[model samples]
Target: MSSQPDLFDRSLLRSRRQRALKAAKPGADFLLKAVSADLEERLLLVNRSFGTAVDLGGHTGLVFKAIEKSGKAGQILRADLHIADPNQSPPDLVCDDALLPFGDQSVDLIVSALALQFVNDLPGTLIQIRRALAPDGLLMATLPGAGTLTELRDSLTRAELEIKGGAAARVLPFADTRDLGSLLQRAGFALPVTDLDTITVRYDNMFALLADLRAMGATSILHDRSRTPLSRQVLYRAAELYAENHADPDGRIRATFALVTLSGWAPHESQQKPLRPGSAKASLAEALGVRERKIRE
Candidate 1:
């Protein structure tokens, strides 16, 4: 048996980040501006003054426009596998692992969108996020969840099996909401919350979506045996499978992005110091709305 190569190498992360930037022609500065404005609203709800924001794994400058519009971005920081284009300066780009970065309890809010699913060490990354947050600070992040790219995955599998003897060795893994919430809690975040949003995008055809992915630099860098190129035949068959099986009416194909957004808070010393023993303990039966029963030894 042969050992599998690391799919989440630094080089691979940088390549993906670069691809994401090249491919993302983010529509509407107003849109990202709206997102920035909403961060202010969310900050109010979190009951914390916005001090600083970090864009973890942020590929392009879409979020920076939002920060600029927010007018509350004096200390906004952008950290990713690759830095932003040097000409743009609103976001001070630092290339580093999202799981680790500068200064402890220094940031008031961290907004990471469409980024966490790519990290191999997600829980560790969350822990790092907690460390970056000030007391009473919040971390808001969105990640790809299960059910995202199911069609593409299915088609790719079919193509690989038909052409090669087995399935493709590499594919991105997404986390589920429950697991993600638990991870945030383990990372020492309090009041962890997870919400799911499903966005269905329509494409003229399957090939169009594939092209969009390529443009978005969302291509796979995890070629364990990338020397084995994806032949035209396999790509054609994959397209056929997608158009035939995954098409909607009007001959358009659909792609679903299952985005799971998570939020958590850094602990305040006052909040932690007030807990009393057995203050909120409950039996499993009580918690689950079932009658308690004695167990036999």
Candidate 2:
């Protein structure tokens, strides 16, 4: 990727999340709900319990609730950028996503869902999360991958260019799976794993899809977004294009959402380690019953 100025307006993103939280209702955020479910499923695979855990960017406390129900942690702390009313269980902290209010290596576990993608400095944020985790602590998170919202991004760009004569950045560029895994290693996370989950949702039309995105607070917060509101002509054209290109047999358009789920752990003495090169005692050719040949240098 070429060097560029920060693509996202983080302040605007925070405002959007705050609005979404304020307007929260049951079943409003299907994506977050899905992500939380996936997070909980991953948590279930781990047989160990944490003494203390923190839910970073815990929007609407969904991750917190999941951790609570699983009983994976004796105590869980919730943190977010918005000042949300704790209602029953108050959040342990409320601050910017980039800022961690905990001591270094003090947390036993950290989990986040559908939040890290909006941060301006995702690498820096991951580094901070790694620093906050106690030795052997686990980190599990979900973020929109490179393939997320491909249909909408394409339709919007073509529509904008056709109607407004020029297009502005409409969708934030997402991190590639390989890059994310590399970032985890750079941040000192051990046994880093990155995988993809593709969810295809059907919408009656583009408007319905757009509404879902808005409710999820997933609208574009690109720093270079067009200052002018999207004109009706462009909106209509986009809808037409979306249906023409992505419509299914039932006429409902299909929207693809690819989520990158990552899991990593803090380095500890007990964790599994890779064997050094040339350390194996047996030869692969002998084990496989294949002819072995050596070339003279």
Candidate 3:
């Protein structure tokens, strides 16, 4: 068995997602829609078409729809924890993000948007995804990066410290872009790349931001989160702090969402490989027209 400590409450996350599904409205999934469009744009840059594609953790079918619209895959399947009604649009499979059902080298492409951040064992999940892809197949995913929800975290921490003399974790910790890139390399993906996109959203007040978070099912699900409900006093104080610290001149507060996109391909002999050390014929000193210095023994 793996010895990694569990950082997220998976059960609570599932419950929250299910609740979001029931309460979802037209614009509640704005983030997902944006990410899906970005994924499609990236796929358009590739010239080849895929035989089969899997939309892993494609909540509400937005990513699946984006993949379908891209016309880059012959067959597309959607997988998620919750399945829609049989009469309505339903996922091809219902499964957890940590456990994928595809066979080895079976899928030509896999896309996941805004779903990998909640995974407790992200490295293992990436390894599974790499194994599931066919040779030279591609994986593209988006995850919330370290800069997301910074203003809210600071406001909540300060308010709780001032009112209750202590603070509990109110937000989920996100992975760093560099760390995620390294994880992709460790998972046996070739030509791994990670890039960040920061989107600043303006809200009238802290309450508005909190409502959006709740509607997105993005409230805290940390395993170490405090069980006691936040008192109204603390909530009001948090709002006050948020307004005092993060508000703009027009009386609007700003929230940051850092989306990190990761892309890599399953290893194949045809892919480009880095040159071996000491294989270059020309020396750096000669190339730069400078004398090389040697350290004294």
Among the numbered candidates, top lDDT falls to 3
TM-score of each: 0.79, 0.94, 0.95
Model 3 misplaced stretches (Cα beyond 4 Å): 85-88, 293-297
Which candidate comes out best when scored by TM-score? 3
Query: What TM-score would you give candidate 1 relative to the actual structure?
Result: 0.79
Q: Candidates 1 and 2: which is better by lDDT?
A: 2
Deviation from native of the Cα of residue 245 in model 3, angstroms: 1.0
lDDT of 3 by residue, 221-289 (tens): 999899998899999999999999998999899999999999999999999999999999899999999
- Report the lDDT tens digits of candidate 2 across residue range 211-293: 87877778999888878888899999999999999899889998898899999998899999999999999999999999888
Over 4 Å off, model 2 = 1-4, 85-89
Model 1's alpha-carbon lDDT is 0.68
Clashing pairs in 2: none
Model 3 clash pairs?
A: none
Q: Model 2 misses residue 24 by how many Å?
A: 2.2
Number of the candidate with higher lDDT, 1 or 3: 3
User: How many angstroms is residue 85 displaced in model 2 relative to the true structure, after the best TM-score fit?
Assistant: 5.1
Lowest summed lDDT over 10 consecutive residues: which window, candidate 1?
27-36
